[model samples]
Target: MSEKILFVFEGEKTEHVIARNFISHYIQKENKTVIKISFCGEIYQLYKKMSEDDFGIEFVDLFPLLQERDENLKKYKRDDFSQIYLFFDYDPHATNASNSILNELLDVFCQETEKGKLFVSYPMVESIRCYNGIEDNFMDLLINIDEVAYFKQTVNSYAHKKYNNVPQWTINIWSEVIDLHCRKANLIVHSKNDFPEREVPQDLILTKQIEHENKSNNVIVISAFPLMLLSHYGEKTASILQNLA
Candidate 1:
């Protein structure tokens, strides 16, 4: 039996890199654990990757509901796992349908858990752009998460007209974003003892073991963004799940 997680993403070019990196790191570093990944919503290439990769993790890039339904139909039902982790960005929409999707997933996981299903969920977290640390002289560090036009305008005004390559700007900006994302994830997983008390479920029974096996999984949600956090600890998270099972 292997541990699994459902990886949900917006599936942009940047996101694709993150997913691949996560899978690569986990598979190489942690042999004890197994990951089953699935992608959903407005994505195509990820489905291609999922098909091409021989890794054990499942990947699907369809509507979230359909993806979950497919997982349920598989040999591993919703109750078969130890945890279900949802990853998504906040979208500006009238209905905020992401929450609805998340809730449905939780409902299924919870239903199965109550029926002696071992799975649990950590819901209602998001990944958005924060300041990437490339502040000084780094004209390429464009903030692409939100306010895209504004971010580009700022980049254009950096007074460095000599460098006009779009790819350079994208790379620089993405690198900074990726680095910040990794830093945040590290802090969250590393700082379990210092987290402020909350009324909501702050930790799960699975947390301790997951931390022991893969310390990065315990970090705050931000670090997991752009999938760097997962790539760093994917195997470890899987190992913990496998060990627990």
Candidate 2:
């Protein structure tokens, strides 16, 4: 039987796009469908995009607060679901937005169904950095990223220095991470919209909360094991997804 799973996150529409692809790839099951729900704005558009694919998912825009409530006790119970998954980043936002979301999930779960399980994937930046062989002290790795003028140059440099060539998946992940980081830098350097106070020094985040602060640019770290489990072991991933669903 198919299960209903909820994925809540604090990113824009693109995050959902990547998540759907990731979940579809990870589950490796075409028949056992999942319902992808989000709280991000413009749910209708996401629903349209989700419908276009044969990923076997029904996407919805749920209220962001659902994560905090218990699935069993709520007035509108989602008892069909075996589990609920919450994906968010512990980025350097003063608002404690991630914790607030977590609290909501806790409130619901404790009140509704003790049987329900919650999975939290966080610090996406560290996840990507780890995949790309970037050190935890990523400030040091910045030199390498900045020096890679071209892929060929990177490869040549890798050969000269005997640095391992990054895997294709790692490269893709790094591309996203780097793009996010650069964009965040631009945001700080250019505008003062979401970030009002002076941007915290990168050195502080890089040295102490490198894993924690990656979310500042939407680059929260995630466990590569989840990705690997979904991609390499198709049959097992299917079983896991089925159970979770």
Candidate 3:
């Protein structure tokens, strides 16, 4: 049997397009693993949907005080997927006001970390574009930065306008960019803290308030997509990435 992995992304268009292309290429090359991708609109919407479906937790239960049932919830079985991953951005909800909801979602996700992973990109998904052999400059750009402004001026500037049309080519460029970034930095394993204010604590512990929470080793938090990609595909993939670069 082939290994099955399901990815829930925050964006419907760009993420879905990129994931489809990347997974298609990956499947063609490996021919053993199967991947599924879905978009759940925004991060908050995705969180609500995953909580209700994957964990069987209701929206009211997510926030006992707030009574809002305007949205419909879906049902999900654990056996539906071998692994589940949530990809989201850290910029919009990094402030103190949004931290409560963020922490709540994190608590829910951390419950099944062994079977579910949370992959967050700082600022936004476009930050991955910064990985084109300029590790020092990329690192410098991240220091003491205004998340919104930086994203607009720098990250969004590199956003591929034709991403939806030619996702394979876009991802190929990303792979090469990451390969160059890793080689230039001389790092075998990239640190998860490469993104500012987005580190998953090594000693993350769950509180007792959540009844459904469980101790799990499944959650794999990452700041850079290249690290995850290279690690998953191995050094041979790196050789291919270099040639593409």
Candidate 4:
């Protein structure tokens, strides 16, 4: 049987393009069939909808949302996917943004075998390119609420040229980037400076981000897609990225 994987994303453009390339380059070889859908809104909106009185704690029926937003997903049942993943931005600047809501959503959806696994990009998705070099301190790239609106341009201007555009990135580029982001995530979760050896729970990353934001009113820049790779592919993802194109 073909293993089906579902990606529910926040944006219709960049997030979709980046993730498709990463999965196509890295995971599809394992015979996983991929399906992509866009939530078409910020994370807070999904929380409000999910927390509505009718939805309750059962809070897990994304196929309906996917079918409503994308014509292609309508025919597929929830059971069709062997694994499901969600990518959304931690747009704390958003009007409805609340740490509590985000925390609840993260806790609820923490398992891929169950509800789904979620990875959050700080401020926005452009964070994937927020790295400048292998040796540079990526944690230095933090954004306050004021900078959130202009972060895409900021990353475009300051990120390493090799990682600036989706079209220009080869499988080689994908592996290199996957290596960078996963290592950066390890720094956030475990205070480690090496590649992750185990899963870093999404809720823990959020807790770390919240602590930083509370102290400085700025979130450390990070991307969702690359971190998602760590969970989906596990520790081998770091080592495989070291060896792959």
- In order, what lDDT does every prediction score? 0.34, 0.36, 0.44, 0.81
Rank all candidate structures by their lDDT, best first, as comma-separated numbers: 4, 3, 2, 1
The most accurate candidate by lDDT is: 4
| Candidate scoring better on lDDT of 1 and 4 | 4
Our tally of clashes for model 2 stands at 19
Candidate 2 residue lDDT tens string, 1-245: 66555454445453455455455644435444455554442222223333455642222223223433323224344565544454443333323344433433433322112332233233431233332333333322332222222333333433222122223233234334333343333233343222212322222233333433443433333322243233233335334444443
Q: In candidate 4, what are the lDDT values of residues 1-245, reduced to their tens digit?
A: 87998888898998877776777777788888998888898888887767664858456576686688778788798899888898999988788889998898888878787788788988788888777875566755678878888887888888888778876789887777777777777887887878887777788888889888889888888888878888877868766786776
Q: How do the predictions measure up, each by TM-score? A: 0.36, 0.38, 0.54, 0.94
- TM-score (C-alpha) between model 3 and the true structure: 0.54
Query: Could you give me the TM-score of model 1 versus the true structure?
Result: 0.36
* Candidate 3 lDDT by residue in tens digits, 131-174: 33344454334312233436545543543453223354665665
Lowest-scoring 10 consecutive residues by lDDT in candidate 4? Answer: 51-60
